[model samples]
Target: MKKVAIVQSNYIPWKGYFDLIASVDEFIIYDDMQYTRRDWRNRNRIKTPQGAQWLTVPVKVKGKFLQSIRDTEIEDSSWAEAHWRSLTLNYRRAPYFEEVAEIVEPLYRNCGDLALSQLNRKFLEAICRYLSIQTSITNSWDYDLLEGKTERLAALCEQAGGTEYVSGPSAKNYLDPVVFKETGIELTWFEYGVYPTYPQLWGDFIHEVTILDLLFNCGKDARDFMKYTK
Candidate 1:
């Protein structure tokens, strides 16, 4: 049975994102949706000396609807440099710092004011390659799907020749199981639970940071560690 998973692109998302992708046959990047402010699109948590710190990407908003993640303009280019420096300083002692740095440093340097969606896609691809994921990754826009949540999602599955659809836990609230069943497609849900122990930089470990944190500290073990929630 062919399985598919859909999710919005997040900036250097958590290990759970990659975990879901790795578990699926085809991973769809749901970038056609509206951009939410103060969300994972622009910001994510990271470990720091004091405590958790938020690493945020600034976006330029024009109007609604027409706004696409591909159109999001970074507010400050210098932020990327600062972020690179911060990660280097914080994770320099990490066992996989050099490896992670080699992958991430160029991302920081090359990302000189680009679209949010483009940036996220690049990051996602990099992470997937690093983790040796074999699933096919695609974008929603590539299908030219119609508007509306259910319609677009169903259409995407059909376009991809997917007979089964997997969704994040959030879909449980509104997505009707019968609707998908009627469409001759089976809907499965996956819940992302947190890992009990992740690699620590300096202080007590912080969870839910970008996947980079996991890769930097845990190295190859990060992939297997992410599979276990508890």
Candidate 2:
């Protein structure tokens, strides 16, 4: 009864993202697809004294055409330091900032990787450890990728030895149920809705900020807030 999820790598994504990871037995970094700009692939939000702000990593795909997420490259080495500084500046006062910082700060400083997917995976794996999520994660490129939308996803799940597929809500758009049914695999959808708010600093609590907001504010208990028993 193995459950699997496949999603593009996101840069320090929101708590909901981690919740999906925690819910499954295997989580696949499906970054072999085309990269989209102004998406969570390279940027995410963090709360500030004034309001929410985006911390984005500049990529070198402006002139290049049809770059896959795994192939996307960071424009320069400076984004890491700047992003780390921004996080420290805004979240320095958070209740558990220092705790999470000690574990995550070195990632920013030591990032010599050029690929966006590699960097995203680095941060994601580190944060998953901090949250104690032990789900087995692998890259999609490691598998024999097929063509088409749902077919590729289903192929990846099957390659990962998954009996059930847990997908994000947006997959309802083009995910063909017939494919799963014919393949004798169960397909389930998970939505990150109405997240319970925890004690947050700065101002009114914002729910969609990066999971770092939850980690900095809730510390080790952040997992309790992000996941449910049911």
Candidate 3:
């Protein structure tokens, strides 16, 4: 049975994000949804010597509170250099830092003036490839989107020929199971259970940081620490 997952694109998301992508047959970037400020949509955490630090992509949010994620533009191109500097300064000592930097540094250097959704997709695709995740990635706008929260998700799964829908556990609060039952699609909650600790650089390991942490520390063997990725 084909499994599908619909989630908003995130900037340098954590391992669990990629885990979700790898768990599915088709992973849809649901960027058509409204953009939320200070969310994973444009920012994420990175481990540092002091503590977890945020690496946020500054976006133009003034007078545009209701813009979709696909329409959210980057506020300044300088944010790229700044973010790259943070990654380098913090993860320079990581075991595989140089190897991972070869793959990620260029993405930052040439980020250019792109929408937040596009930027997030670029990083997501790169990380997926690094871990050999072959899941088919698509945009939400590619489908004829319907109305209602659960209705839209269930319909999208159906349109994608999905026999099962895999969603993050957060949706348990609002996702209506009846919708999936009517569509004959089994809705399953994805659990970000206790992940195995890797050779992290920092004193205390933090899994909430970006997947870059895993890449910088483990390089080609990163998949061994991840759940769904082969």
Top-scoring candidate (TM-score): 3
lDDT of 1 at 179: 63
Instruction: Quantify all predictions' global Cα lDDT against the true fold.
Output: 0.81, 0.90, 0.93
**lDDT tens per residue, model 3, 17-101:** 9999999999999999999987899999998889999999999999998999999999999999999999999999988999989
Residue 221, candidate 1: alpha-carbon lDDT: 72
lDDT order of candidates, best first?
3, 2, 1
Clashes of each: 0, 0, 0
Candidate 3 local distance difference test against the native: 0.93
- Give, for candidate 1, the lowest lDDT window spanning 10 residues: 62-71
Could you estimate the TM-score for every candidate? 0.92, 0.97, 0.98
16: Cα error in model 1, Å: 0.5
lDDT of 1 at 132: 83
Compared with the true structure, model 3 gives a TM-score of: 0.98
The candidate, 2 or 3, that scores higher on TM-score is 3
Q: Considering TM-score, where higher is better, how would the candidates rank from best to worst?
A: 3, 2, 1
Candidate 1 to truth, TM: 0.92
